[model samples]
Target: MNSTKIPALSENTNLRYANFIALYFAEGLHMGMLFVGIPAWLAMQGKTPTEIGAFAVACSLPWTFKFVAAPLMDRYAYLPMGRKRPWVIGAQLGLTASFVALAFVPEPLQNLDILNIAAFVASFCGALQDAATDGMAVDVLEDHQQARANGFMGGARMIGSSLALAIGSWILNVHGFTAAILAISAMIGLMTFVPILLREQPEEKILPWTAGNASIQNQTLQVTNWSIILKSLYSLFRLRDSMLVAALMFVSMGSYNYFETLLPLFAVKITGWTNTLYSQAFATADLIGGIAGLLIGGYLIERFGKKRMIGIYFFLIMVITSTLILSKTLWENSTFLYGFIITYRWLNAFAKIGVYAIAMQCCSKKVSASQFTFYMTLGSLGSMAGATLIGPMKENFSWDLTFFLFVVLLAFAWLIMYVINIQKLTTQITNFEEVEPADKMNSLLPNF
Candidate 1:
């Protein structure tokens, strides 16, 4: 299709905002299906927790390491419509097809192995969709818009995930597995049309077969080779503030992951709540928390600034976590337990979008997908570290100390925020240059 006789997405304020929120909502759709809906269904079918957990791992592995494929997004994409939109559309199409394939999986309970393989394929496509969408967001969105857009997008995703879980589960019980899968497929398949319809630059083609060429912005942003991408990254890693931000990203997310991993055990085993109660209560709290973020997270960031908002949010986290440590007597109190979960969830959602804004500010267009994904990968590593230490933490340390350790990590991250100079890093990113040759590499920001 040719251009629709309209302004390009980046130039159209309302459409641009709508596009990202919708795309990210699509992200929440499949995540809800995989993580929430399917797990609950499997439990109903008498699947062991280990079996359910195995399915989760298969779906998750691709997300944890998706960064390995991130450079491809920077290195190659159909630049005619937009550098990243083609990949977004392609990934979404594959993702939809994969869901349809999942619906038709023969004898799923009897063939967990095959179902898992299909899950992995679907997740891989989801990861690509995530990467591509992030790249496009960084490229087209202005700095002022990033934080608000992220808030809205984050909320949309949480809402989508919540809706998917509720609606998909209803369909599963009433109609069947195939019906549930098709519903998920339809949700994502419909959102794919948004990117397909809009041009990133006004004169660019809507479809490659239509009569138009890559915009100059696309031409400027495209990386010519792997060497350039790697060398550019090499230079970026040398900056002191970049390192600080990366560390902050890891610690902050790691702390959240640690809390998440420990919550079930604390609630069900120690506090004597049933698993069903914990799940439903936590899900409801998380949904409310997500809406809170969507409404105020960006407004706070806009008024107070990213670093300060981060400081406030993490400080709140420390307060709550420390309370959990200090008030061991209140563990079984229903009021206290639900209160902690809701507050903590709100803080996590708030802090995350702030981090997303900071990350986008850190990226240079040349390797935005790669660079942003690297910071994300570090967070994944932090999650691994947090998850790995849990068993040992349980075996060797008291629960108070275990909670205390993550609180300490959060404190460290809070302090790191004070040390980072966003204006300086913005300068570095704005003046960022590709390494002209290997000879001048300082082992620094100027060459990136």
Candidate 2:
């Protein structure tokens, strides 16, 4: 295998953090607003649950195929233009344009196709940008820094998501859908400047476009062809521990997605909360709890290994998710309901950060984008499955039963963790080397 050394950490830690945080924040805004704003807007327009699910599915469907774009993100880069920055800028531009066009769509409820299609385009762009960002994160961060960075990245994501949920829902509620879309469009457009300011060189050096290191640029592009990409991906699956991580991917966030999809509707029915109130709950609870989780989870990972943290988070999630069913029983006590929501979201974010910390370890720098995204794509599939099923399950079996079933799924994921020793797997993965295609072919011959 080619020795593609991981890039050294950028000298300016603050600037690097800003770049990752800003991109993740934008990504969170794009997803959170769409999920919160569009669904609430449609529900207010008297759209059925199925239609709301369809809208979310339309937005999320692109993420399922995000793996398809990951290889290109790993390969093909206009070096002078900035290796990953170009993809980030282009994707951001596409999302901004899509949001802008969404503002002009007439009677969005009636013209659902227009809204769905625009959302689809925006999602596609966001997925590509996400792949680039994850790749950049993997490239820059050392193995030891993974937990802390994941904490910050995950926290920033929730912050952005919460901000979008609160602001977008309020705008949709007070002003209207067009205003909400335009507001989001403006936010995305403004964020594009963050990446623009992120030059590859330090203050004294000239930009890469002029006198950048050609050798490094060429090395970045060396693994561009289909044969290499395929072989690398195939090699990824060959890891002894890949199967366990893959299974964890499918079930890790399933319960969170399931509840997140139905929570708005559930709030309306059970707590008699409006869109504005729901968004406020999400913003306050998620922001405060998510930040807390990031801080706590980061520290915990430093003290106890990620495997232990994962086990702890899994137990917490099972407990927390199971308790959400009690929201119905506590409907009259708004304080209790809010408290439950906050705790549930807190534990959920904590658990997910644990997942992110581990997933970062699963990646190989050679195909960081494709490999990391391959795991994320599986996670997204889990989320999509949860989104697709929760509504129908709640409708048929009732909310309490649905929550119970989701907790069971979480428990099952927890069991998988126990069965395979993640710490051992991670160690093995760290030591494993990717065999070159030629080496593999030669090994296939019968020895004399």
Candidate 3:
């Protein structure tokens, strides 16, 4: 790698960061529609909780399995246009098409299969785009910038998801399902243009379309292959710390996924609130409190240290989850419910961003997408497990009991965090920083 290839801490760095944010934001919009807007829509049509859970599974399974294709994303690139950018462009187009198709599906409630199918397809594209963007961020950002970048990335996601939820619900309420889907499609189309404009780090090969670039156009290098990817994965998982991190990632959030799945339905059942009200309240919390958390998360991690900050925030989340037992009464009091959500969402955002920052630290830029996607896959598994369990729990037991279970599961995650010694992992990352990227990647995962 040439020194000149790396962008300095200047306008170029800022531009790349901005592009990363936009990419994540677009992905989040797709998530909001699937998680919040669609669930609410399904409920409005009198779908059962189990049916809604199935749809959530449909949307999430792609993300959980996305790691299977992560290496392909790392190995192949259109060197002419840009490495990751080309993948982003293609995925965004697919996402747009999926939403547009969803828009035309008639009588969405009666066409449940079509809706779920579209959501699953959109999710797959979003996951691919997300992997590409993560690769780009890993390739470009410096070690010092990792935490802050994750913060901004997380912030952008929450803001986009929240805004889409609010707007999608309003559009659904006003102009019906077709309009809502069309609006989502249009928003995605506009956001897709953000990555198309970014300049990928200078490659030896130039675009074939350029008249004078014929000499560089035919040059190709095959850097990523199955042998390399398999070697890397083996190395990543062989470490005890990596194993610990996987456990932490899986159990860290407790029942957050389940809670999220249930919240909209709970609001409607308890308060007779419509989708608009439910979407607005949750979106407002995520947009306001979530942004605040992301803005401060990096600073807080630096100040208090990642371990201490995570412990504190996780404890705060436990306290907040316990409060959900009172949500029935709180739902009856809109003011109190909003206050609870704002405070809880803020703490949740803070803790989750910290986890992501730590995950970013674990990857070597050499195989950033594959390594990071592995961790994200762990997270998705945890979420899927939680969501799958929640439906049965809610059906058999009371909501209060379910809340109690969430608290218990979170405590298990906290226990793992206590045992992991985060300071040691931080030291490992810092040590890797001092080595060459090639050596570091090798040390993390050596060939057998």
Best by lDDT: 1
**Where's the lowest-lDDT run of ten residues in candidate 1?**
434-443
Model 2: per-residue Cα lDDT over 181-224, one tens digit each:
88988888888877665654332112334434433533543465
Rate residue 262 of model 1 by lDDT. 95
Output the lDDT of residue 361, model 3. 72
Candidate 3: global Cα-lDDT?
Answer: 0.73
Residue 101, candidate 3: C-alpha displacement in angstroms: 2.7
Candidate 3, residue 262: how far the Cα is off, in Å: 6.1
Candidate 2 Cα misplacement greater than 4 A, ranges: 1-9, 46-54, 106-111, 173-178, 199-210, 215-222, 259-279, 293-296, 321-333, 387-402, 418-437, 440-448
Runs in model 1 lying further than 4 Å from the true structure? 1-3, 433-448
- Cα RMSD (Å) per model? 2.2, 5.3, 5.1
Error of 3 at 109 (Å): 4.4
lDDT, candidate 1, 79-125, per-residue tens: 77788888888988999899999998988888999989998999899
For residues 1-448, could you state the per-residue lDDT of candidate 3 as single tens digits? Answer: 3333444222376776687778878888888988778888788778999889988887977886668777887778666655566677888898899889878887878877877888788888888888888876776676567766777888889988987888897899889988998998898899886765555544422233542211131122224567765665666667667777788788864367867777777677775777677667778888986578557866687667666887898788778777768656665776766677788778878778778777777675546678788888888778878889877898999878877787787778777767775556656655654554356466655344
What local distance difference test score does each model get? Answer: 0.84, 0.73, 0.73
Error of 2 at 70 (Å): 0.9
